[model samples]
Target: MHNAEIAMIGLGVMGKSLALNLVDHGFQVAGFDLNSDNVARAQQEAATLAAMPGKGRFLAAANLTELLAQLATPRVIALSVPAGAVVDQVTDELLAAGLQPEDIVIDTGNSLWTDTEVRERRYQGKLRFFSTAVSGGEAGARHGPSLMASGDPSAWQYVKPMWHAIAAKVDADGMPVGPFDDGEACAAYLGPAGAGHYVKMVHNGIEYADMQLICEVYHYLSEVLAMPAADIGQVFARWNQGVLNSYLMEISADILQTRDPETDRPFVEVVLDKAGQKGTGLWTAVNSLQEGTPAPTIAQAVFARAMSSQKTQRITAASLFKAQAKSASVPDREAVLDDLHDALYCAKLAVYAQGFDLLKTTSERQGWQLDFAAIAKIWRAGCIIRAIFLQQVTAAYQQNPALENLLFAEHFRTELAERATGWRSAVANAALQGVPMPGIGSALSYFDALRCAVLPANLLQAQRDYFGSHTYSRTDQPEADKFHLTWNATPRVQQAQ
Candidate 1:
């Protein structure tokens, strides 16, 4: 739209909220949605707002023609549609409707980075493409959402004020834990088209892992201490005051504390233990595997949810095996809570570390200015998994923007050293007592990956050298670039020289 307000192509919950935010920021906005209901709702919401003091009002275009007529040829239309083929479908349709390459199309959905990569190529030098991951869901979308966007750096400047107008505030640690009450909340550019989605993908992946670890902690309490949900929640609430303080953990406590309206019993029992997973968590696990990243906890969390989906089979099978609700003799509640929290804190760090490592690796391979510390700050505010530790991540990035990896950072090293022992013991205990602590195992894996001196695959070195004349390094002299190789015996041959 020639010097017009931001236009939205999909006016669903997220789009509507973003549109309203634009309106609130004094941008004369125009929107179009396939669903008539959403279109009508936008109109209704617009009608309820205070009369514009001096700006133009928001309009819901009746059709593509109407929307095109309202905006400039190279429109700044953001798509909040579903990811995958549908995104491409909309882009193609918009192109057919005379949307020029000079136009800007922002995909504010959780599209795979690959999609963004492809779209960038397909658009070539014509249109601009941005893969933006919008966080904060329904509520955050309206007031403010942490925006991770990547595209033409020049075009980025055009909408930056809008991003600032809508983002959450960052803290001293550079994390986003709240809306920018003073006008600096959640949004920032993440580099290029696919960069935003890639970062967001990792964010969700970490979220998956973080939530599972919290659940595992609860599992340890319920099985070992026979503690009820509320009591376990109290333990988490206490942890919230320390290093483990986080949005997910805090919400978990709220869920447990919530009472039923009818029975006055806990509302958790009323809700299904069987949680359903959308594909992003699983996609993240798959991405990690393909990229040779250590994402065990997130992968396990995805699997755990899948297993939860088999409720009917699980219920039926419980009858097949005669089992007692055996309770392990728990240590003192205070002691157990402290130990578990120490374990949880370490595990959570490991989880974030693993994810950040992946980002570092990805940024190196691809050209994305990840700004790990900035990302950590953004995660702090507008997302589902906002935690206090993200500040550390942000600071780490700010100090060394080209930080090759996270574990090598000095402060992180100190933090890990202090908490890792207890975390390791927690995992060992879980393994010893048959506790399913995938999150802890993942956390352990982070330490293992960062140790540099040892690797589980090192045992295969001899075998590696035996077959292909491949070389192997000795643990004794790792700092030295020396490697040992056992060449396969070859038939006697004269030297070519």
Candidate 2:
């Protein structure tokens, strides 16, 4: 009788890598894919792993029936299929193929959080529907990745050990620990239903903002400062040694220094300027709007990508409207560099603050009760956004779990206070140089708006009340009491009728 502890339904890159990870951790896995070639590749890789000592075997099945037959009773199935309809289709097939009520199905794709909730409801009682948002791309899949799991509490118990075994590890200081290192796994059960996916979505939104902020800095260094690509890469490498150290920063340095094989030019220069995005960032932005939360940096990052996609229009517009010439006098290079560094750090703080605030707001609304500190700790390694910076975030939440915003944290408050001058200087320079810094600029504005006790919304309220009868609340009275007014109250002439 064939016996396997778990079954994997998709054998794409992520699927294959995860299956291999499971086998490496001494868990027997039954794997299946629609494509015969993928199955063969998995089998070959499994053979290689099987040769190694202290590894479990991989069994390739021709069909779902055979796959289920290979698994042990009350089987646990993990799906890495595409986000939308494919997930439902596979779940339906598994039910048809004798998946029992006690069996657990975990969706490990970047599905919309609402969809995850819907699926859990749709498959309730028939089978345990669960989800875990996996991050760190293909390499992390093969080695270790940060996992955010949610759904039925009972299902979590069944999958916890397997997830912890394959998740990346980190030390107390948030430094990534190697496989042999004695460290804690970067995996945790976030909450019920869509909480895990919701956290992952916010992670992606912050990622978008972080990437755009870096690109804006690169643009300033390259276009405004006229620095060479290699020089900028060196600068990025240096920055990666400090607070800005992160997976994206490290990869960006490598990308910059790399040369295209055909043209022998800087790899970045050879690539197209247009950036593509999946739907996660858009979902984050839309959700922020729906929740009445301010996430301008994240929203602007999404818009930046949208603007980049219209490259042809930008090209024509470039010729049509001329920008004012920049001043010929160059500022002190060292001072400017320092300003940019501090500016980036400050903007990054704002981005995280926005992301966390959104998460907190949604968690309360959904009754998820997500542990902010735990979430930050898990993100310390094996995720795209992993950084030492997250250590401070973890500390902030640990000190005060009900923190209104990250910017209000004592540590972050001091950081912003010390860095405000540099942040202002950097934004001013970018504007004067005619370089677009939407991510950083929007972040600065978000910070200022939060700091302000009184804003110009009074006039805005009046305008709204005038046109749409959307009554305005008086500043002197309780906000619950709204009032309206009639402006142009002069008596009408009798002849007008």
lDDT of 2 by residue, 299-336 (tens): 99999999999999999989987965478588788888
lDDT of every predicted structure (CA atoms): 0.78, 0.93
Model 2 ranges off by over 4 Å: 490-497
Candidate 1 segments whose C-alpha is farther than 4 A from its true place: 1-3, 52-56, 72-74, 171-180, 316-330, 464-497
Query: What TM-scores do the predictions have?
Result: 0.88, 0.97
| Range of the 10 consecutive residues with the lowest summed lDDT in candidate 1 | 175-184
